[model samples]
Target: MIAIIDYGAGNLFSVKNALTYLGLPYQITNDLEEIRRADSYILPGVGAFPFAMKMLRQTNLIEEIKKQVVEKPLLGICLGMQMLFEESYEFERCSGLSLIPGKVDRWDAGGLKIPHMGWNQLSVKQPENPLLKGLQEGDSVYFVHSYMAYPKPEHLAAFCEYGVQVPALVSKGNVYGAQFHPEKSGEVGLQILRNFGGLTK
Candidate 1:
């Protein structure tokens, strides 16, 4: 079973809905004990980094998450993905979980739009990455974010170009992150979620 963390950073109904469509058993809760006992966890977010980290701290799940990711599979989606890094320059430069060595920052824009919305093709950086299993170089995924992760190239699983090399997918050991909302994307999204949901502890 999987546990979808509830940190009040975003509504996770869509994530839950996707998991249900996959027939995966999951529970949404803020209880640290439940989190500790879950087979795997999913941290889905759609808000600011500092505020989301604050909420996780308030719920007393920061240490739990830090400890949990080391032993089990943990996937962070969108803003949640940003929190898995060392820190974020989102607004005031708040520290992240440090699960991966990197920082989050806004796109350079380069005359393009701020939030690189809509569908974008993923350019596989680590083709052998298990998380990207059946996905290919040209598979399109949906994204809606103004900031992106700058993890070490070794940690980048895939990236997409949007005036800048946006971190599309990343992983380090058992921890993984998707910059786009897999629940909102189409079949490719479902495949991504299914791949995560099938992870063994």
Candidate 2:
């Protein structure tokens, strides 16, 4: 079963709805033992980096998450993806889950609006990653964020241009992420989640 970790900070309903629509059975909980034994896991969140980190630490799922990702498939979305990185330069220079080798940085804006919302096309880089299984370059997806991950180029599965190239899709071993909300990005988004759901270690 897939575990949609409820760390008290996740935007659970939509992700749950997405999973249900795809006929994927999942559990939303922070129980350590359940997390340890789940076949797959989804870390979904919609919030600030520092606060999200605080919530994850308070729930004490940090270590369990670390352990789970090493052995099973783990997918992080939006803020959850940001959390998988080493650190984020958002709000404060806070540390992340350290699962991926990268740092989150604020978008340069460059005369464009902040929190680059609305639809944007993904400039796919590492299209061979399983999380991007059925996707093609230039496919549009929704985005709503002010900061983006700046991981190593190889870790970046795809990018989207705003004022700059934003890390839209990322994967490192068993861990994957969608900077955009896969649950809300229409069919394209759902397809991304479906791709993640089918990934196996």
Candidate 3:
């Protein structure tokens, strides 16, 4: 089962509903004991970086997550994905989980809109990455964010064009991150979730 961490800043129910629709066993939890017992984790968020981090720190799950991720797979969605990086400039320069080597910053969309909303086609960078599984080049996913992570190229599994190459999916060892909301991305999204579910023991 996957522990959908409740840090009081996540899109918890939406993620839960998606998991339920896919019949994937999950529990929304803030309890560290519950988190430690779960097979894997899903950190879903939809808010500012500083506030979310503060809330997560309040829950006292940061160290637990840092320790657990070394062995089990963990997927961060949207804002959750940003927090997987070393730091973020969403509002101010704030430290992240530092699981991946990169930093989140406002997108320089080359005169395009700030929040690169709507559907965007993913361009596979590392086709062999297990997290991508059945996904292919041009597979479209929904996105809604003003900032994006510039991860190390080796960790970038897939990206999308939005006047710039935006990191769409990323993975390194047991850690993974999705810059888009798989729960809101339709059938392609469900396929992504299925792929993630297949990873948990």
Candidate 4:
């Protein structure tokens, strides 16, 4: 079973619904035991960084999450992806899960529209990545965010150009992140989730 973390963030329903539609078994919970017992875990979020981290702390799931991602396949979406980094400059100051070596900051483009919301193509940097196996370059994915992660080039799995080359997909060992909401990206997105679901150990 796949565990969809519920830390009081938005987009849980869509993630769950997508899994259901795909005929994939899953559970939505904040319980650490449930998280650890699951075959795989998905961290889905859409909201402020600091507040989301606060919720995780309130539920006492931070360490549990770190444990799971370090030893198992864990997928993070959007803000959930941002939370995997070491720190974020979203609001005043906030620390993340530090699962990956990077920092989250708002887009630095001078006049480009903030919260790059729309369909953008992904440029596969590491073609052999299981998450990007069947996906190709120029495949459009939906994105809706102001802040983006800045992991080193070696950690980036795929990227998308929007004024600048943004880290759209990143993975290190068993941990993976997608800046775009695959649940909202139609067929391509569903395929990505299906691919992730198939990565269970």
Candidate 5:
């Protein structure tokens, strides 16, 4: 079973529906015990980074998530993905899972819009990455975020160009993150999730 983490974030219904459509068994819960027992864990979020981190801490799932990332395959979506990094400069100062050495910050550059909304093509960095298995270099993925992650080059698995080369996907060992909302990225997204589901070992 895949555990879809619930911490009062948004757009979880689409995620749940997509997983069900794929005929994959899953449970949405904030219970640490249930999360730990699941074969795989998916962290999905849509909101501000600082607030989300606070919710995780209040629910006492921060350290539990750390443990799971170390022990099993943990997939993070959107804001959840951003939280896998070392720190974020969203609202205030906030620390993340630290699974990857990086920082999440707003796109303060000139010309480009702050929130990069809509579909964008991905440029696969590590072709051998299981998360990007059958996907090609220009596969389009859905994205809706004002901030993005900046992990070290070694940790970057895939990227998408939007004014600058944004880190679209990243992974370090068993911990994985997707800056785009794969649940809403149509066939390509579902394939990514399906691949992750198949990684239950």
Candidate 6:
């Protein structure tokens, strides 16, 4: 079973619905034991970085999640993905899970718009990355965010250009991150989730 961690700040139901549509077994919970028992994990969130991190700390799932990801795959979506970085500048200088080497900060956006929302085509960086297995040449995904991660090129699996190049997908070892909401990205999104499901095997 895959654990859909509910730390009280996630877009939990949509992610759950997507997983259900894919027929993937999952459970949404904040219980530590259940998290430890799952084969993989999905950390879905939709909120400010500081607030979300505070919630995770309050629920005491930080250390356990850190431990679990060392042995099992973990996918962080949107705000959840931001939390995987070393720190964020959303509301204040806050520490993140530091699973991936990067920092979250507001992108310049080149004076286009504040939050670059809507569909964007993913420019694959590392085609051989397993999470991007079946993705096509021009596969696009939905994005809705203001802040973005500035990660090392090696960790970036795919990216999309807005006013700036946003990190769309990132992977390091068993951990993966999607800056866009794959659950809402249509067929391309489902294919991404399906690829993620294939990671456990």
lDDT of 5 by residue, 1-201 (tens): 988888887467988998998998999989989987888888888889888888878878878877877768888999999989999999887998788899999775468776899999999889999999888889999999999899999989999888889999999999999999999999999999988988877
**lDDT head-to-head 1 vs 3, winner:** 3
Candidate 1 achieves a global lDDT of 0.90
Model 3 stretches with alpha carbons more than 4 Å out = none
lDDT of 2: 0.88
Q: Which ranges in model 4 have alpha carbons more than 4 Å from their true place?
A: none
Q: Considering every candidate listed, which one attains the maximal lDDT? A: 3
Flag clash pairs in model 4. none
Writing each residue's lDDT as its tens digit, candidate 4 over 1-201 gives 999988898589999999999999999998878887988888988889998988888989888777777678889999999988999999767999998899999776667888899999999999988898678789999999999999998899999988788999999999999999999999889989999989887
Q: Cα lDDT of all candidates, in order?
A: 0.90, 0.88, 0.92, 0.90, 0.89, 0.91
TM-score per candidate:
0.97, 0.96, 0.98, 0.97, 0.96, 0.98
lDDT of model 4 at position 193: 95
Q: What's model 5's overall lDDT?
A: 0.89
Clashing pairs in 2: none
TM-score of 5: 0.96
* lDDT value, residue 130 of candidate 6: 82
Task: Give the range where candidate 1 is weakest over 10 consecutive residues by summed lDDT.
Answer: 192-201
Per-model root-mean-square deviation over C-alphas: 1.0, 1.1, 0.8, 1.0, 1.1, 0.8
Error of 5 at 64 (Å): 1.7
Output the worst ten-in-a-row residue range by lDDT, candidate 5: 106-115
Deviation (Å) of 109 in candidate 6: 1.2
Q: List ranges where model 5 is wrong by over 4 Å.
A: 108-110
